[model samples]
Target chain A: MSKDSNIQIQINHKPTHLPYSMTLAQWVEHQTLELPVALILNNQFIPKGEWAQHLLTDGDHIDLLSPIQGG
Target chain B: MGPSAPDSWNLYDTPMTSRLWMGSSHFPNWNVFASACELAKPGFITLSLRRQTATGGQSYWKLIRSLDIPILPNTAGCFSAHEAIQLAEISRDTFETDWIKVEVIADEQSLHPEGPELIRACEVLIQKGFKVLPYCSDDLSICKALTDVGCRALMPLGAPIGTGLGLLNPFNLERLRYRFPKIPLILDAGLGKPSQATQVMEMGFDAVLLNTAISQSVNPAEMALAFLEAVSAGHRAFKAVPMPAQPNAQPSTPSMDMPIGDYRVGAELYGN
Candidate 1:
């Protein structure tokens, strides 16, 4: 892919442009995620073990969730 | 027997000495929350999930990891079984723990648990090997339905969430306990004071899950300690076997054992 090439995707419902052919693992490593997060790609959960193998393409929806305070 | 009698209960096959399960939210700061958790030493800590913000760098997982206690991830905001099931799966995957506090709210105003949806969720989650703890109302039929669906424990609310109303229907709780003596019933939500927690414990509830009562107090840590003491005291009092209630008053001293009085009244007594 050329340096100017970009892949548009939605993360947690926000649209963003990323480097083409970026794997889910790469996307995760690039972000400052608190450890032990669950990821969803296009409404389907991608387990932590498969992040390295799973690839994110254009127009994909990614959701990252972590534990917060609850009663 | 002394006050320090040993007692323990099990939830989903895990033995725990403390019956107080706490929530880690609404504290003045994380430091106060940490202090409260350390002091309270609850049997389980309840947590939830939300979207990670770009600026959200702080990790509650760090706090949870440091505690080394049993973590119960909740499906707090989910309104449907499907939504709750999805969150439960994600929570299980992320936390690597099968324990979940399932809250399927029916309405926005009351925040009451949707009984039928909760049963469906419990059925699915339990089939998937999740140790489900369904947060339900004090209604017996709903509780029975959850149990039928294989929920490990039932968390009946004492009042509306965050209202601090505290055990709106004690009779229902008592009836539930009496009917299902073996079920592990944890009074969850609506408790505003340590005394309310103690009262529920005294009524034979296996445990109590509290958050606002401790985290929202003037002194969170101190309130946590107070809850600990109150739970212990109430449990002890329950075990001590309080005297049963009676319709008529009974005198401590026996009339037959009293000293006999002289047959004739004294001159001064007669005059009076």
Candidate 2:
């Protein structure tokens, strides 16, 4: 891995096993990946429609939350 | 027997019951939630926002639309008045509504209201042009402050969070009613049965707001309908005050002198 190589990321503090050397679009399009209820990159709320075009990098903290009962 | 007391309640000046105000928590399943709400027919479903999985579609929002009810956003989780103010803004933006159920929880376990924080939040919310409904303990001071600050209504808690107790502080609520006769007073949270709701309404509460009681009932659809009827009965009774019983020292048996058998007194018939 060179200095410019994509780095690993964590989600909801879970250690991501792999770093996406791919574009954000490519990573989301992977058939095995389930659709996330909500995507957060570095605490940013990303629209689901932008998943394909959004890119992921090393050390990016992506967070997801499930819609549940709250009031 | 005090001349058989007649009904004392006045004909008019009855409290008006609100159509719909719901809490969005505690349903075992989405299907049941949908069915129960449909049967209950609430116009507003209360909710507070937390971060959710952005990967999936907006299922919660979609379901809210499917429920066909207006999203009555809430600041339920916020503890401080400052936090509640911020949450209300975000709720308005996210839900796209200015209606906010202001909840300023001071305790984690019971989730009772911090009256000072509630007033603080209501002050800011009213300034911000939000239709605020502060959920506080059954304290008349808090209710009066909320109304003073221009909150649309005051939603006083019946008991602790999810305790399912009903109108534990009726005395205080009565005082609250006496003070603020104009503002709508809704009993929010901790309602376990329809009778509890009826009692609150009978005491002149404008409405009843609940979630878990109806959602967790053995038959949610039936329970919802029961609440509907109970609320209606309470409101009507408040207006009608059917009659008040007079406790007299003398027995109504007439000293066995005049009327022998107008009605049966007990299992044994008299003069038969």
Candidate 3:
């Protein structure tokens, strides 16, 4: 394992720090996402198939979205 | 009515008896929301997407899916065509349905639909095989353009969103209805009371989408029932074909049955 280093990532536009070189799957586990959700990485969609291997780094704008009530 | 009533209308390819489409937001709690959903018995329910909250889980989504009712996902917060299209695609993936309520609001003050952006987004969505229902203003030309672009249904706001101002321009709504009788016109937003919903349905709108009116009421469940009844009654009135106007008064009685049949007052005095 590599030395733990802080990397900033924006989740739903809220800046947060995670261990550097964290995979998207690890981030999902870190965020405790048990339900179905979609992810956008740097203004682009990151499919679920790629989340397990995709790595996140500093300044990545991530938006975790799920269905909410609306009119 | 068991799903399909005598007046069963079709949206895209689905047949629906109820004309009330409820928005699944703003209820006091989940219990109240469940009760209201049960009472309203809408043909479909609308939902949107947002970032997950700590306390907010996916329970509402599970509950909504469990109801076995049709779902209409919306792009409620999108500001431009790009944002609207992206959210809409994500919604389709999450909801597993192609039905979308395309909303492109340029600002928050009025929450009015950005006509061009909305139309552009709808065009792209329609191309992607989505059943697009665009929430738009009561503009005949814009409505025409939306239909021209092949949206499944057209949802025109009765007034501004959530103000409950009630149909600000019935003239325009009526014109939209008159102009596009074949198009499924679902009156959406700005309806505060059951009567307001009834007015739109009575005006020959195919349906209505209600949110704050029911969810924000003193009793959401009760208000839902009221809206259901009002929508049904209004549809019935429309089907009954109300009477037309008359230019002059007409006697309802038989003219020959009058008591003064032979009584000509001035004729008798001048007979000599």
Model 3 lDDT on a 0 to 1 scale: 0.86
| Candidates 2 and 3 compared by DockQ, better number | 3
Q: Candidate 1, after superposition: displacement of residue B222 in Å?
A: 1.0
Candidate 3's displacement at residue B126, Å, is 0.6
Docking class of 2: incorrect
Better of 1 and 2 by lDDT: 1
Best by TM-score: 1
Between candidates 1 and 3, which one is better according to DockQ? 1
Residue B99, candidate 1: Cα error in Å is: 0.2
Distance from true location, Cα of A28 in model 1, Å: 1.5
Q: Write the per-residue lDDT of candidate 1 for residues B104-126, one digit (tens) a residue.
A: 99999999999888899999999
Each candidate: chain B TM-score: 0.92, 0.83, 0.89
* Candidates 1 onward: DockQ, in order: 0.66, 0.20, 0.52
Q: Give stretches of model 3 more than 4 Å off.
A: A1-10, A13-34, A57-61, B1-6, B247-272
- Model 3 interface DockQ: 0.52
Residue A14 displacement in candidate 2 (angstroms): 6.7
Candidate 3 colliding pairs: none
TM-score to native of every candidate shown:
0.92, 0.73, 0.85
